[model samples]
Target: MLEKYASFCYDQIGSYILDSLDYFEDIRPHLSKANIQVSLPEYVSAMVLSSMFVSITTLTVLGSILMIGSGIAGLIYGMILSLISGTLTLVGFYIYPSIIIKSRASKIRDTLPFATMYLSTLAGTGTSLPKLFKVLSEVDEYGEVAKEAERISRDIETFNMDTNEALKNAAERTPSEDFKNLMWGMNHTLTSGGSLRSFLRERSDTLMNDYRRRVEEFSETLSLLVEMYITVVIVGSIIFTSMSLVMTTFSPNMSTGFIVRLQVLSIFIGLPMISGMFIVLVGGLAPGGIR
Candidate 1:
């Protein structure tokens, strides 16, 4: 359904969308690195169409509700909110490819050391480059590395590209700098009649060491995060609730209902929101495949 809508949007005004955006060409590499299958014009069209749809829907629903409640002032506020939402939606679509590229790079980096070790083993067995990638592509354990391998394998087998040419293309498009270097290294080794097995073994060792360092760094980060969680969410909530209860008890003029609502909001809403935010922060900071 989304594809059909995007296609329809593209067919209607894709040329105008493409011509209006000076940075459309600049995002091509990002799209390639992120492995987004849509063309630049189609993507821009989809962004424009989606933003318009969301803006119109928000305006109709929220404006009607607000208009009924607060007259013209509420309607004006609703329009402002709709505009903000539409702008944010447009910005989100614009940056989505970069986010995907970063995520893919992280996943690839996390899995590369083990995948390189596996490739070293295969290389030692005198397996050809295409065959090595084909085997890697079939292994689900490697995650994004496996998917990247599948692309390389497809380039060699299905596209009839030679190993060097395929590696070059992969290096050009890959989000991970380490993976790109590996491809280039392998290409050079093959061209120079050097030993593929030895090169891979050395590269694998380097990557493993880097991976261990990253894991140790994350361990330190995790400890700090745990301390923050306890301090800010647990202890802070308890202290705030205690203070609120004491104030309510001492101050006879304050509304008991208001105090009770404050306590409820702190416990039910604030604590959960803080905890959820912490969880998202930790997840984003942690290396891929660990959490």
Candidate 2:
């Protein structure tokens, strides 16, 4: 449905949209890296159309509700909110490709060590390059790396691209720097008549070592984050709430309601926010492939 809408939007006014944009050219490479199937004009048009739809919906719903309760002032506030929502939606759409690229890169990095090990094993058996990739592509255990292998295989089989040409294209578009380097290395090794098996085996060892180091680093970081969460969120909140309660008992000038509100804020709002932040921190620090 969205694809159809995007296509229609592009067909109607794509040239005008493309002409008005300065950054769409810059975004083209990101689309390729992110593996987004849509053309640049289609994506931009979808973004515009989606943002417009959301803004209009927000305005109609919220503005009606507000106008019923607060008249013209409510309508004005609703309009402002709709505009903000529309702008944020547009910005989110614009940056979505970069987000996908980053995620794909992370997934590729996570799977690369194991994938390369498998590649090295296949190369040791004297399997042809095309057959090696085709086999890897069929294996779902490699995650994003498998998808990448599938693309390479497709290029060779379907697009009629030679190994070097396909590898060059894959290296250019791959989101992970490590994967890009690996592809380039493979291309060079093959072209120079070097031992592909030896190169892959060496690369596999290096990647495994790096992966181990990352996991170790994440273990240390996780311990620190655990300690911080305990001290700042749990123990600190208990102390703060207790102290506030005792203070309200002694100080008649301090409103009991205000003290209660503070306790509520600390226990309900602050605790959750701090805990959520710690969770996010731990997730970010944890190595991608440990599981």
Candidate 3:
């Protein structure tokens, strides 16, 4: 498979090209947040080398085939074409990791409210930091929250890090602002000898209230949308149909059969489109769920 081959290529030959790139420092932090298993330098190097190889090969073949009888201008055109294609590929390669990070962040954000509530509940029991994280990691219902907790546990146990250090590292690497803030709060509470239970309880309550407010706002918006849909799609569609029928009746050139059939087509296609737009709008604006 291409994936296996790409992995092999990165492992075997990618590091060799890393010294040539100057942006390794800037890219290192993103690699952590993106959950990419590869080193930043190696990834960039592999991408650069692969893109170069592809560009060179494309230029050679296309130039030879298309510019056989042409002069330097033809060769230059081929190079330009190949360079553009290769540059697009390289850009996509770099952007793919950021996309992954965004998706992960979205999932984390959605599940954060419930996870905080769970933490607040556990904190009230006077649980130790490691045990609290272990319980969180073990719970399968929390989705990304559980996965992130597992990573935190692994850092503490495998890396032999203290609780505060582990939390700080997690905060640094997590793509979710909500999760980062939670970890920072926990870290600060531990360091300040403050009450973790009260902090988590208050934070969880805030998230719950914010989530409820968003849902209430969405309900109000949905009511307005329903009225709009009736006015614009339903009644408007009926009025248009009536007008078309009237036109067909009055005009000798217009066909009733054609107008009715067109109305039928609009009913099927246009009605669904109007409904789908509302669905998309609600989905885009809905508060992320704690799932």
Candidate 4:
């Protein structure tokens, strides 16, 4: 319903998107890769998201100011928060399609070696390029990459595009660099009279080695991150807590409110935000499977 409303907003609102077309051209490929269903023009999508977030943020800031404090200063502060929040919301909406593309790309990259191995094995049987993809597309075992191949096959068969054109389309829209390169390589090989099977097999082997090297490097980075987390969270928190306690113990005249407030601030405000940052970091680094 909210999605419909946003689209409606795009349609009913005169197009601010046309004036900002260049700002969103880079996102068009990602939109297809991410499978976002937007009937509106790319520009319209951006406009709708920005407008909606700003509207919501305005209401939220007004409510907060009314409920919590009142004055010119409060209004200014609230507007500042609203502007920041709204900007971030617009940024998130803008990047969300790209994020989805990257996620699918990660999943595709993780399984590219296996997918290539499968393709190589089929190519070895002397299957033509079109037939190979047509067969590959029917096999759901490769997951999202297989689905992508289906699109390629559909373009070639249903839309009457040539093999080269379909492959080019696939390469342009795929989130996976591996997949894009593979398509381009295959297309070039098919065009230039090279052996497709050997190319696929060699590519599969290379992709497998690359995946292994990345996993090892990622593991090493993870170890360093673990050490950093321990130092920052466990050691830092313990030290901070101890200092607070020691200060309270030594100062006989220390106010209980200040001591309690210090504890609350450290635990409630600091810890959750630190943990959240690490969580986002870990998730961003996590790409796909071990194999």
Evaluated with TM-score, which candidate comes out highest? 1
| lDDT of candidates 1 onward, in order | 0.91, 0.90, 0.83, 0.80
The TM-score that candidate 3 achieves is 0.77
Best by lDDT: 1
- Per-residue lDDT tens digits for candidate 1, residues 1-291, read 645776898998887787676766777789889988777788889999889988998999999999998999989988998998899999998899999999999999999999999999999999999999999999999988998999999999999998899999999999999999999999999999999999999999999999989989999999999998999988998898889889988998999899889888988898899889999999988877587
Candidate 3 per-residue lDDT, tens place, 161-253, comes to 999999999999999998999999999999999999999989998877877887788789879988998899989997998899789879979
Q: Residue 211 of candidate 3: its Cα lDDT?
A: 72
lDDT of 2 by residue, 1-291 (tens): 656877987887787787756766788899889988778889898888778889999999999999998999999989998999999999998899999999999989888999999999999999999999999999998988998999999999999999999999999999999999999999999999999999999999999999998898888888888888889977887788789978988999999999888888877888888888877877776767754
Native-to-model Cα distance after best TM-score fit, residue 87 in candidate 3, in Å: 3.7
Question: What is the total number of backbone clashes in candidate 2?
Answer: 0
Query: What's the lDDT for residue 125 in model 2?
Result: 98
Error of 4 at 176 (Å): 3.4
Q: Per-residue CA lDDT of candidate 4, range 109-137, in tens?
A: 98889889999999999887888889888
Candidate 4 all-Cα RMSD: 4.5
